[model samples]
Target: MSIGISMLFTFIVAFIGAKIGQKLHFPAPFMIGSMLAVMLFSVLTDTAYFPKEAKIIAQIVAGIFIGQKLTRSDVIHLKYVIKPTLLLLVILTLNTFIMGLAFSYFFHWNVLTGLLATTPGGLMDTTLIAADFDSEIHIVAIMQLVRSVGVLLLFPTWINLFTAEKAQEEPAEENVESTRKKQPLNKKHFLIVLFVGASGGLIGYFLGFPAGTLSLSLMFSALFKLRTNISAFPIQIRQFAQILAGSMVGSSFTREVAASLKTFFIPALLLIVVYLLISYLYAWINKRKDWLDFTSALFASCPAGATDIALISADYGVNMNSVAMIQIARLIHAVGIMPLLYQFVSFFL
Candidate 1:
């Protein structure tokens, strides 16, 4: 098929999926729906493709939105998340090692491949590092996709179930109306955010931070907000980013990858089981030790992208800043620490 035709089909499906998702009030509906639509198409048709740059662009956009949420006050709150973040990192490392070993033994795959597949890092981050380790990229991609989708679906459910009361405690209508009327942003403010987003994204891409494009964009936006004033970005841009990210992730599951999943199903199931167990254990500990509410601790501990997790946490009225900081710290270590540790160990062994 022609590239033009492929692109057309992809967008058409993604648009329809996004509409359906929003109508149904799904969490990150555009992204979730687009991913599911693409995955379904790929599985049924035995073919799938999307622009390679889609995920990166989505990440940058997501970063901008997340960054815009930050202020100096949020930075002051960072100290609160530190203990839970550190504890969660330790838990993640132990969980990764044990689950990686178990998956390797069960699937008859190499230990490194198993580890990469089970790690809570973003899909692209793990896939690229898997390449360096000579692991099976296809397997790693599929497994990571499964891990992410699982987290996306489950996070909201857990929040709704456990945190509904807290969510219901929003300020009254008069207060919300008065607040909105008082602090409306003008065009110049949005332009500043856009400018900073582009600058931060470029700097992040070149410097090679973990999820750098998104992280840096967020950081730059936050700094801009701190120095000036808070402003609103078009919510539609975030939705578009979700669609792009969802489509990219969905299209990654080619027919070959779909066919291969059954071969590794048992291990995949075990990996999910262990991942959740570790996540919940850390969350429970945080709630008890750090004095965070259950919802806040849970969001802080979930193994997912910082931006994605933070957005969902906001929807549920969890402490968004805490979740964002902890998740970003996890991203840094997942992309930075774990890979380097493996590389150094590989040299000796």
Candidate 2:
């Protein structure tokens, strides 16, 4: 078996470990259960079964899955979700910037590198930038890993908590009413998505925004025929797609980085709490307006893969639009805001 597949196995093992930990009533940090297993094996065994480069490739594949998730329907959902989406994308990115600045203030790391270092984006994205500044890839990677683990572990915990709080605040009768209205199914939505996705990608290629043009495929279609109707995107399929995507991405994180991750203790823990709050505050405000489901808003707002966020949102039976919206918003932010922020901070601050 190619070492590439080892990451897949490792991800599966970690996921199963997470489930088992929950079952065993172990208070282990959600990713802790699985991460420890990887750690223990590395300690005792000389074989580096899951090599480093192979893991990187797996994560790159996950990026492909994320890039494809932006079909037309998700964008249609975007209209309804735009408010929360803007709120979240800005909040989440700012959270990263602020948290990085705060962490730097306290920990004494490079400011620019700290932002990249503390980002909730997946491991590679954060580390790539961190590496640019020569700020310790291992530390950057660990911070992202902790953010990912915190996301998975904290999700259900927050779900149960929010559900209860939502219950207490809203009339019990309203909950009963909303649950019924939530149940409906559609497939046309998926077909519309395929067209926009395929056609949009083609247009993007022809038009050239570099990678941004790829999005233009949808941009063109959305610009003109947006009023064109379609079914809604399937919640389960989106989630499953994300799981496959996240697994591909998650698998790439192997023992090598985990072993060298000791210095990440502070940033990792800090990013975890900050990211959790980023999602929480986003949900808390939107929850007030009865926008979408709370946990889903949190899950969908994550700066990670679209598939991952959407799929997690699908868990609550809501479409992944909230997740997808935030993902797109961030990409937009990265394009629009990052350049300015980079210039301002680099020159002024």
Candidate 3:
């Protein structure tokens, strides 16, 4: 519960995450196993072990990593992802808001609390933004738990079912010839991504961009000038980013919050439906173009992290790996997605 212990917990979880990700051959952006373990620990235990004091520090820890990697050049790099990614994020935000509102109105909870309950991001991200609406932290935590459970479990199940239904398409065929068409990574691009992400954080901090996700992403994109520079960040940086992310995510536990979590069933079940429908709808819509992998488009479009589809793909034999790949693509896209979209939005409708 103390700061040191909390950070230790984060590091441990991150280490576990890294190990599991490597062992499982999960080709995605996160440590899915560690996430499930934490959520499960919170669920099974009757005690609240997360400390409030450690919470903000955990967030700051992650913020530093996210902050440091993002730079100025990324301020406006990839022109394409900016619009689509922003649109997707907006759509997800709106959907979550609607779902949260419905949870309040239909389930009869406080509107502020319900709204915070459903916001789609990390649990702490929910709380940080939830404070703006004066929402109850416990309720927000409870809702996030429910949402995380839904995403963690059902995503894999869906992938299993989808892949099973199309067994004929198993062992995806790759286009070796087209592989030559891809772009290569370079140092100029790496620096640009780092620069954009950092600059965006600086800009957002000054302009009230609500934590540095946008700023970090903008700066990262601006810094990475390569049209397809995927290797700008080193493994260490990526690991640090996940540690920062997990520490903040894990530090949100407490006795009161744990007690509040007892009533997480209804919300959790409801969110599974929400997750399934959203994933399917997004996949269906994005699948319209007939890309090499249909699963990739669907997984990329969903709001869940990279591991969900990857695990599902491996577990259920669906193109979940493809989904995971798409997830990476989205991250690459995120570098330039929002800033450019914001610019365009600034210029026109």
Candidate 4:
């Protein structure tokens, strides 16, 4: 297909997918919906889909958003969760390694693909890195998708009962007024983000870091925020980035991957088991440490996005603030630290 036609088609399909996802209130619906829609389109047609700069921008946007999540309140909360968070980090890494071994031995998958699939990071982010590393996109995408959706659906329910009961026992805290007034956005803020994001991404790209563009964008944006009050780019940018990244990732699934998926069923199941085990262990630690309630900890520790966890917490009476903070710490460790750790470990493999 022509470039113009491909872009048009991608947007149309992504629009339809995103609409459905939004209606259902799925996590990162734009990304998930567009990815599934684009995957189906690629499988049914001969069109070659490409979004050359979209993925890079998406990474930058994601990194910036994540960096913004690290605030003073969040940092203070992390002090309480430092022990549990560190333990969870070790557990998550170990779990990924074990799952990687299982996939390599049982499914005849390469070590690279297996490890990437099991890495407890954001679905879109992991898949983007998988593509850069030349892994099987379909398997990695599906595995991450399933694990994410599973955590989204299953963990919240298990913790809901406890959270609901706890809510009944404790009186709701009074809403406190903010000391600082809200400020309006200005052009200066926009210019600052643009410059920082671009420069940081370039440094990361040239540095040859794994997911370097994202890492550098996150670091630079975060450090800038430390000195100033620059807010993240608008939510619309993150959504558009998701749509672009999802579409690209979905289109990457080839016929060979589809054919081999049947052989992957058992490995996928094993991956789910690994996720469940880690979630339960982390939840137990959260409860025992008194850092969070059972429901809050469960959702916080489950390998899903903080946004998804926060949404579920809002609906199910889990402590949204606590879950968000803990989940952010886990995400920073998983995405910022684990990729390099995986690369170092892969060197031995």
Candidate 5:
């Protein structure tokens, strides 16, 4: 019952789940495994607990892990993605209002709640913002939860299934050799990387920007890596972050939230279908335009958490900078702009 004891128990369960996921070779295994395990525990016993601060810590670690991969060339190459990013924002905003209206009409839910529920923002950010409106917070939380978990479960497997042939065609020996040639990690440098990431995350958290904690931490970490060429961090740290994130998400499925799902099952299914269709459609368009490879475009277009997508992109060996840039753009829009748009639409309703 104590916070410390709950956290310890939660981590133990999460670690076991993560190991099982790894053994099964699940996509994004640590996150998916821990999330499923924790969700089951929470729903059954109602004792699972992960502190809110732990989620922030997960974001900080994830940011640092992704940031160290950036280079000057990647920064310069970002300009090439601006067009696709703008196109994505336009499509997503339009879809939000369209879907929100449909949900309101069919489910008889409040317009604002429907909008918040349908918005493609981070689960925590959207749910927190829903509190300010005359909306059903639980519905928003559940819908956003579905969107986050659905994307994490669906996209990686989908992308791999489609791209497996391409991966097989590549020179395996070269890839393995490149990975093996990386310099040994230094403990002091790793500590400094953590310090920079924490400082940036703190600044972002206090600044109160949308998705700022992870974004700023990543920006600072990338800048430090560019400046000093110290981009090494233990792989285990990244895996730990994934487990924490998964546990944080899983623990959100309290009994009350689960009970509400029956009433909103259709709406939840609709949400997943619509988002996936939109993601695939736009991803196809961008691939056709030759703006990015299909894999990168798919990750960029998917309306998932920016940090989550960035962290998973590494496993697929795609262009993470592009994916992160566009996902962050979508996140900022969903968090900062969609609420205002919904407020304006509410008056019309």
Candidate 6:
């Protein structure tokens, strides 16, 4: 098939899958659904095609989505959770190295690929970075996807199991609604966000930094938001970006990737174990130190998507602000620093 025809087919499949996922209320539904749908089509037809330029565009969109989360108030709130944030980063960094090394040694994968797969970064961010490293991008995407979905599904249930008594006593806190009003969209501001993301992505692409496009775009978007207090991108835009990213990732599937899927079982299990252990450790420490309550600490330390964790924390009636600040710090570090660190380690290996 021609490139245009292939892309169109892939995108249609992705859109259908995204809608199905949304209807089912799946976590990170658009990307995951689209990826699965495209993977099935690609594996069956072997005609899936996602251009490099389109992938770059997707990265820019994902970066901007994350960047819009940052605001001046979030910066001021950073100090409140500085210690927990630092602790979470430290634990996660250590876990990344230890688990990454284990995966490489046991599975005979490249160290960089192992590191990329093991890092508890956002699924899209990690997968994009995997491309820059020439690592097993498919494996990284699968592992990160498993991590994200696992956390979203399991963490809340585990928290509820442990905190059932407390929840019963504090039933009033359940269903507390958000007071923040949604901002009306402006065309000029939307264009500005895209312009900033594209500009930063271009600069990063030219600078030879690891995953520079996405990282720099995120940094630039966040800075723009902080400076101008204008971060307005339509939900549709975000969904479109996710669909594009999912399609690109899905188009990478082939016979080789499919055959290698079974090897992920042990690694995925290990990833979950490490996440649970570290999250529990953080919660234990916090319980003693009283830096944050047990629920907030667990949620913040869980290493899922930052925004999702923060929103979930609110439903639990934990310190939502602290959880959000800490999770954002984790997200920023994972997006900006983890890829660079993995690259540095790769050089020595």
lDDT of 2 by residue, 63-167 (tens): 232334445666655577877776776776677678878877787876776776666554544565566553556556666666665566565566556566543
lDDT values, one for every candidate: 0.74, 0.53, 0.48, 0.66, 0.83, 0.74
Ten consecutive residues with minimal summed lDDT in candidate 5?
A: 169-178
Candidate 5: what lDDT?
0.83
lDDT tens digits by residue: candidate 4, 1-349: 6888987887788778877877886644676677677767777774637575666776676666555545667556656766766777788888888888788667778887888888888777788778866478877888876666545445544554445665454334211111111334466786788688778977886885455676677667767776686774555566676777667666655455555557666776677666766777777777787876666567777787644444334434455445555666776676677778767767777
Question: What's the CA error at residue 8 for candidate 5, in Å?
Answer: 1.1
Model 5: CA > 4 A from native: 166-183
Best candidate according to TM-score: 5
Q: Candidate 1, residues 1-349: lDDT per residue as tens digits?
A: 8877876787778778878987897755777778778878877875557897776676667677767777778788778777788888888888887887787787787878877887889887898899999678878888887777667766666556665576466455335545755775567877878888878887988898786777788788778777777666766677777777667767777777677778767776677666666767776787678557777777877886665675445445566667777788898888889987667656753
Superposed model 6: Cα runs more than 4 Å off: 100-184, 276-349
Ordered list by lDDT, greatest first: 5, 6, 1, 4, 2, 3
Better of 4 and 5 by lDDT: 5
TM-score of each prediction: 0.88, 0.63, 0.57, 0.66, 0.93, 0.65
- Between candidates 2 and 4, the TM-score winner: 4
Return whichever of 2 and 6 wins on TM-score: 6
Query: Distance (Å) between predicted and true CA of 172, model 1?
Result: 7.2
lDDT of 6 at 17: 95
Candidate 6 local lDDT, 121-161, one digit each (tens): 77777888798985888778888866775566567666876
Candidate 1's displacement at residue 106, Å, is 2.9
* TM match of model 5 to true structure: 0.93
In terms of lDDT, the poorest run of 10 residues in model 2 is 56-65
